[model samples]
Target: MKKILLSAVFLFSALSYAQDVKFGAKVGLNISNLSGDVEDTKSLIGAHLGGFAEISISEKFAIQPELLFSMQGAKSEYSESDVDYSYSEESKTKLNYLNVPILAKYYVAEKFALLAGPQFGILMSAKEDFEFSENDNGITDSGSESIDAKEFYKSLALSFNLGASYSITENFFIDARYNLGLSSIAKDYTDEFGNSTSLKINNNVFQFSVGYKF
Candidate 1:
């Protein structure tokens, strides 16, 4: 029993010493948009900065987990009509999140890899900028406002990421990814008519990043 235990410990130590672990930092740009129940929506340009750790499990496989500060949202326009006037509004919504993703990577070539994973995001802030115009008897009124939108959005979000990474050198790489939201971002609320409704918005983002490994 003592000899078996000693042998097991030696094997474990050998495996640990053979594993390759690396750490790095990254910065990127995001083109984000919201989908579902919205009209005339456009993509918003945002940015992300983060750090990550990659643990090599085999020659062709690795696990990477990252912590990132990400900015995402959309731009939209809509028109409404009343008995006396017609109005149009344009809005841009901004959301800030702290995101964590755990990815499984498989190397297909010596310097290129494919990764897919689940990501969890915690909302940090939300805001909306609005521009409004109304026409009454051909007279036009235009104004703008900025408002806090945090209460209208969910605090937690879930997404799936599909991406590829190419190593440019021993310590540098470029990454491209798409994130698809699996959970709705809107909070439930009552409308002006006392009917319960939700915005039913989901986030979609395409990200490009440059990273360095140490």
Candidate 2:
């Protein structure tokens, strides 16, 4: 990992002298959800802030690398009823990550660019808040709780980014992107019999942002 980062830095430095380089910062809205091994899931609203360097490779091509702090997760609700009892639960999971993405941008038109990339994320925190209610033969109970869930997830995640950007002015732009997870974010568990099982959850996110170039 260190060697790879060093090589990237060297390459970026070399390219900076040969092409136009732009540095910028962006803030965005994130709509995130968890998929696989979970039911009744919905998107969670979050935010991301980032900085990037864009190096123009040609009249229509560029390479952009970004470092971002992102908040992502999902919300779920479940309910069941029987003649003797009824139960319901709602939960919200929050995950925080430091993300690095190296993107290739192709200008399809003077003001529009298509973007694709691989995003690498390092997990920072995981937590969940849940509430439950139960009724049994006219008896009722309700409760809420919060749990630290970092240990249940893996430390790293890999995802693919697909998006487009529209330059509104010389130094300003707006973009929308979707990140599709390629690696499972949940950890596996080993049993005494030497078998391993996992929840097989992945993170999916849609991002909308406004940025300025300097």
Candidate 3:
């Protein structure tokens, strides 16, 4: 196991050494959703703020890694009889780690390019809020209560990124990307009775960013 780990590290370092690093910050809108039992929560609106470094291995290839505080989750709602219950949860998912994304850039023209790559997100700080009814007064008075909960990270989740960039000058560019999450964020939950709980989370993010490509 140690040998395998060392080998993987060596290979990654070799690849990284072969690329040039481009540093930048990105802020974008997030349109997220929750799958599985949490389906009632439609597209949840959120945002992402982070900084990234793109390592250029060649003129058309690079490895980019980032640290971002990304907010992702869903909005859920249900009604019982005349009483209504609904809540939308947004997780201030702070991901702190090195994300090494090997990107393949194909230039459509001198100022236009398309990029495709895979991203691994390591969640650092994860928090969630619950707005529930304490009583059944008109479906709980239509009032709300919120509580902060801990979200445990199940290690790194795989994701795919596809985007296009337009460079107006040597130091300026605009990028539009679609990131698809490929892991289930559901950690096993058990009550005091030792029974398992059915709760799951997945990654689904849409990002649009404009940056200075210095």
Candidate 4:
């Protein structure tokens, strides 16, 4: 993923010299979640800010490359029951990432365009905040904790983007996109019983943005 992103940057740089390039900055809202091998997860609200370069290759086609700082993750609640104890937990996971997406844009109309691309992400930080309660026989206990969880996850994430952009005016635009996860970001773990399990978690995000071209 790193190599692919690096090659794309070089390609974009070369194209910038011959193409009609327009640079822009954007700020956005992200509705994110986690999917795969997990249950009881809810969407988490986040934000993303980015810069992009659109290189026009023709009247109706262009290539856009973007660099963004994104916040993503999910909230979950679950319970476990056993003969000796009953336990319930609620957690919110927060992940920060630096992402690069190289998109192909097809102008469907003069003011509207469709976008599709591959996004490469490097995880910058990960943390989990949780509250839990356990009842052992007749005894009850409850607590909450905030922990750094970066080491438990893979540092690289890969996703595919599908969306559209509308040019509201000559220098202003609005975008709506869905980023679908294509790679698992969770690492394998060993349980207390010494059995190893491979965890699968992927990022699912919906984004909306407003931008101005410079």
Q: Considering every candidate listed, which one attains the maximal TM-score?
A: 2
lDDT of each: 0.89, 0.91, 0.61, 0.93
Each candidate: RMSD: 7.8, 2.6, 4.7, 3.6
Model 1: worst 10 consecutive residues (lDDT sum): 1-10
Task: Give one digit per residue, the lDDT tens place, for model 2 in 18-120.
Answer: 4688899999999999998888799999999999988898889888888999999999989999999999998999999999888888999999999998888
Best by lDDT: 4
Each model's TM-score?
A: 0.82, 0.87, 0.71, 0.85
Q: Could you give me the TM-score of model 2 versus the true structure?
A: 0.87
Q: What TM-score does candidate 4 reach?
A: 0.85
Clashes of 2: 0
Candidate 4, pairs of clashing residues = none
* lDDT sort, best first: 4, 2, 1, 3
Off by over 4 Å in 1: 1-18, 78-89, 132-142, 192-194
lDDT of 2 at 20: 85
lDDT of 4 by residue, 83-182 (tens): 9899999999999999988888999999999999888899999999999999999799999999999999999999999999999999999999999999
What does the lDDT read for residue 181 in candidate 4?
95
